[model samples]
Target: MNRTKLTPLDAAFVQLESPGVPMHVAGLMIFEPPAKGGADFVRTLVSDWRKETRIAAPWNQKLESPSRWQLAPCLKTCQDPDLEYHLRHLVLPKPGGQVELGQLVARLHSQPMDMRKLLWECYVIEGLAENRFAIYMKFHHSIVDGISASVLLMKGLSDSAKDRKTSPFWIQTAPEKPFQPASFKMPSVPAMLGAANNVLKLFGRSDSLTTLRSAPRTPLNGPIGAQRRFATQNFDMTRLKATAKTAGVSLNDVVLCLVGGTLRKYLQGITALPTESLTAAVPMSLRAEGDLSPGNSVGMIYSIIGTNVADPVLRLKKISQATNVAKQQVLGLEPEMRVPYSIASFAPAIARMLTGVSGKKKPMFNAVVSNVPGGRDDKYLRGARLLHCYPANIVFPGMATSFTCYSHAGTLNVGITACRDTVPSMQKLALGMEEALCELEHGLGLEAHANPRSLDVVEAAL
Candidate 1:
């Protein structure tokens, strides 16, 4: 059996998981039916995946003695996994549509993964209104982060539409030329001292230190129950990119603007709009240049998404400025110094856990907004064309809502996951996001020909 040690970040994810909060990241992929309709496509795909009894390295591994270690967890691989238990098939009731699919996914996501077996599962769903099929797959946060998960899924897909016979990710074998694993060595005393000194220096920075303080509480920040609600919407990538170019801002800036406007409208409707701007914990990828290993390599930085602004264009400008400031602060720090900075930011959460406090009084951030870069190339799984890809992120005790956007195949897919009680009207929020985009398009004087596709209608229709 192969054994490996989990990093500190990975271990924290495992320890932080509770019955009410399952620390898992998942994705929903909608696909068109296969062109050749001779047999059951899903059944054939599952049969092909089950051909190989030997599971891959990380997928075959499970936590070993999880509660024994406080800082790090160890993994042990099982030579063979129970395919019947890991792979599942489900069918929706009559008149199956996006609503039914969203409800089913929310139910599936509510259950935490069993630590005794592999930390992932795949569900093939059928009975959509348009004869479409869906795939819902989830992995524990400790196993893989968003970027790594996207990469893993991309490996199973083909860049060309003609490559219909390509093998799935589970059945594919490791490359013949294995990457050389870095040798392990103990850090020198001087090196350790220097690292500690750098961390101390970061704490000395007034801005960095102030960021550690608690953010003002909002309705979205509180203790979360086990139930969850999921909603999704899509936007045209070309229009967003064009707006960003015209505004001299980044694509992420445009996304945050939409979120800010939506949150503002939602809060106004509920009469809980905070006078102060809302803060978001934006997760930044920390993977080394050209490094694409399957593990967690990310850190979070807080940004003030100007939800208090009344005008959409003004909100966009403020968001752009705030993101720029946040980016500059992060870029100014040395690469080695950033890890300690991130760990230090989590101090408040750790303190809450130790003190047995629920943290409803003060939240670290109102929500999490993340933008994951998905390649522009059209991808295909077996012979099915990928329609939309939505990401489902985790929600913790203090943070009840999270937003994740993935740009895939010339479209930007937005996913919102929230606690059922905290955000009961999530579908309204999803529709509001579309409206925010439309407002931006009109503000820019490009509404007549802004989106080539009918994104507004399609997003709400879904």
Candidate 2:
């Protein structure tokens, strides 16, 4: 049996979890019905998954922390795990449309994972309209970050559609070395001094302090209820790339502009637009050199969304500048020091959890925006064509909404998760995103010349 202690960053995610806040990251993958379709097909797949008696190292492990001295929890592998307990099969209610499936997923996401067992669960949903099925899987933040999860998923899927016998991620053995706790050694005096110097340098930076300051209070920055609403829409990658080319900015800048414009429109509709622009905590992957081990290895950088700016072109310019500044700040830090600096940047979030602050209070940022790059090739699962994969992320105490962007097979899928009470109509925000993109295209003078295929795909999906 393998066992390893969680890093401070990983443990922090666990400690931050509360009944109202479930600190798990989930994904919704829709697949076309298999060639040999029937209720029996699902049962057979579950049986195949169950036949593997031995649970994988990380999947089989459960967290254990006995005393205050043990701040980091250890993952102790279970000898035998009940596959049926972790993998579930469900049928959507009649007229199993996207609306019904979304409702079920939101409800499932509201509930916390059973920590008494492993820190993950998977649900196979059937009865979707259009001969489609879906898989909703969630993992505790401590288990896998966005990049690692993407890597794991790609490893499980096949690049060629002809390959149908490939096993799912859970049943496959880990490709990298088994996880082992790093050997503990007391730091030398010089090493300690160096760390101290880095800490002082990090805090001395102006941008670091700005990240700590409270963001402008808006309706979205309020207390969040347990209920969640998830909305998804896909954009044509070719169209976005063309827009980026015309604007002379990165694809990410184009995305941020879209989000900024959408947020401005949505908040304006409700008469809650803030005078100052909204800021988002953008997560950056911090994978060490040649390190492909699975676990959380990420840092955060705060970026202004340029919501205060009215013109679409001006908003894009402002967002580009803000993102460039944030990246420069991150680049200035030593690789080893980035994690510490990242943890320090979350001072406001940690404080909110500790003080039980009301949602009405201003937040450190308006939301968390993440962009996880996916494989470019089309993927298939057991002869079933993969339609779309949308990310569903967690919402913290003060932050009512979060956005996750994943690009796959020439499509950019944007998933928005929010507290139902705070953001009652997430569909409005989703529609706003499309409108924002169209505005950008028009502003850049690409509306007349750009290929209509990209916009057509988006319109069809929505």
Candidate 3:
């Protein structure tokens, strides 16, 4: 708190306002309450915050780390009533369905979190599908991301239904461990000087050249709108995984290929898909070992997902290769290598700021696709069973469609969030994804891994 620096939490606002951006800083969590106690779960979280000042902002004004961030609400409360932070509280609306709860979540996201304090909120949802309940948390783009959010929520929730009745589910992560340290031990004078020299040397090089190489012009990235559209889909992760294994690619690659295939079919002969591999900004987790909390612990990796290829299986192969090459390029760079480029954001010229704010950014990637790996087993809130968890991601302008997938217990839930105006037929795209995925399975000669019966339920609803 004593450190003077512009924290990553604050920088997020600057990133959000930028035009031609596809990323949305938000997350959704689903919970199944045990038969006996649910209120205690909420009570525990509130009590934990009271004991520690968890709200903070990153002090690395140098911008060395993303997760090693700071928070707000530093002053301790003097009164019990006023002591409670309204941002953290209980939400029990008159009995309504899970879809109704979704409507409420949508409303919360329509408004941005205020930077004056802790820019995050948590909603305790009841009346969910089946007997399960849900908890939805929204943190500023500057703070926690989907991966960190998942880790923190798991620790907050009960390991067993009986555990839900107890308070202090887990210790809080305030003053969380920094996202990274230069090293475990002090380096020799020569080594330290060498590291510093490397940073200075990179700064000496033409920053504009490297930054320009990363920026690509495409239809995907642009200014986002205030309104967001939410869609949910379920895919057989097992089938997808098996297909990927057969193809010697990753689940992510398979999914990326699916996006390309579906888009090609949907937009065939309309705009002529890109001839080269399409790019994607992959958000990688920066959190070290056990330091997980409710704040941003993420960084960006510009990836070129292969949409240039036409064949489904061939596209998968190309995507996996392109991603490997892109990640290698980024990883090979020094930590401070991106500093000069980020500094360009603070340049004073109105033309420069306007350029970052309003123009159609050169395509860094074709679209944004992220897959979060979660539990493949079922979880309970109190006594109720969780039926489904639908995700609604934030939407910016040009890059309208964002896809996030997570699995819990035995089910894989995929959330497709986009701009209604841009992806007007996103529901159809969701269906197309299913068909594409099946086509992929067929391509790999795998029939045993067809979609589950639940696919019927989703298709019927459509």
Candidate 4:
């Protein structure tokens, strides 16, 4: 196959990647044994996956110039990658549970990928309790964002539990479309006038761009080490939806509120909580519906999460108001201007990461909070019921933590990835999230819901 040039954004991901910051995104999926359970269920699946010698696009693609931390000219397909090297099998140590699983994922996420080969790996991990095993797959972010990566991982599953003929994800071909810039459209005269009016009004608002000149320098924004800490939390969709309905806000608004409250509590415990409300750099996807072209296509918006407010209900209102204004600013811009606006919005943060001045200066935002959609149905792989799928993403210099969540099968799965050393006892954030949710419910005069299990083991093992 002919070599294809990497998009500028994709190349930037590769060029900026380092041992301290591996630019890859991963999904951890735990599965229940088939109705006719067998001890070798995961082993058999791994053996079957090994036999599929043929590989597909993106999985088969690699940097043309194979050099770590160096710019690559193009991406070329490797006709055959060593299947044994790419597909791995492992077992958790004694008392295999959430603590063990989180530790293993953090270790794996910290290791950089081999640039000379295809940029992906699949692991079949066994030995969890309750006769359940897991499949963890990671792909370089240069090739796929969290949404696209989730799509690829779930594409090879079956909706029916009885179906046992599902193929491995790597063998399936990706959509053939290449990355194309969004078409530029000339704004109508009235629309342009309206945008100008909105800009004028935004200057008077407290959550305006002027307010976003710099983020509060909290412990979360700092240089990171090679090691990481991964934590998972899940919530029932019914309760969150009901809360959103009762509060007359979008589900996302409630989610940001939950995040704000969680961070507020955690920071206060450390006595490092900034006096000012923190800002979050939220990722907004640029891909239109049905645009499955591979590579990164996302924008950014900064929202002020009301950390200063002690009242949960009031905090939610402040966050919703800030986020609405930020969204309006982005949506008000013309199509062509949106990308530039996003770039400018994040340029300072990117500069900090590159120049190694991350914690030394004010951050662009305190953290990155991203939300992606996972399918609504229970999916299975060869009749193995997919129970939980949690995301594990990257944490670059300055941004010590990332909160990425996806809704799957009537639940919301949140993955908190952080620098192990920088954010000590990171699992506290997981437990904090639960407490914050309940607090919000009570503040709204709603009955508290049962909290989902999130592996609240003792402090993290070194």
lDDT of each: 0.76, 0.76, 0.52, 0.81
* lDDT assessment of candidate 4: 0.81
Off by over 4 Å in 1: 66-70, 173-214, 350-358, 448-462
List the candidates ranked by TM-score, beginning with the highest. Answer: 4, 1, 2, 3
Among these predicted structures, which one has the highest TM-score?
A: 4
lDDT of 2 by residue, 1-462 (tens): 567888877776777777788888888888886666665666566667767775565667777652223457778778678777888889887557766777788898888887778878889888887768888888888878887766666666777767857685675544464455796566566655554564454334354332535368888887789889887778888989998898888998888888888899989988999898888888887775555566887777777888999888888987888788767665655545556666665544665675678475667788888999887888887767777888999897678899899989898888789998998777777777888888888888877333342342343234
Candidate 4 RMSD to the real structure: 3.1
Of 3 and 4, the candidate ranking higher by lDDT: 4
lDDT of 2 at 79: 68
Q: How do the residues 1-462 of candidate 3 rate in per-residue lDDT, one tens digit apiece? A: 243333444354434443233223555565555555455644554565557433323211112232312232122211222224433454545565434554566555565543333344556555544434565665555444676656554544444544433332223333466566565454456644544443343223222211123434545455556655565567766777788899998777787777767666645534746555555555555555676554555544444544555567776776687666545444544544333222322221123333454335443344557776676555554443445555556555445667777666656677777664565455555666777777777777878454553353353235
Candidate 3 at residue 247, lDDT? Answer: 93
Tell me the TM-score of each prediction against the true structure.
0.88, 0.87, 0.69, 0.92
| lDDT leader | 4
**Which digits, one per residue and each the tens of the lDDT, describe model 1 over residues 310-412?**
7777888877876776665556565556665566555556556545465456775788899988988888888788898999999877788899998898999
Residue runs of model 3 more than 4 Å from their true location after superposition: 1-10, 14-24, 32-104, 166-171, 178-222, 269-277, 331-361, 375-379, 384-392, 448-462
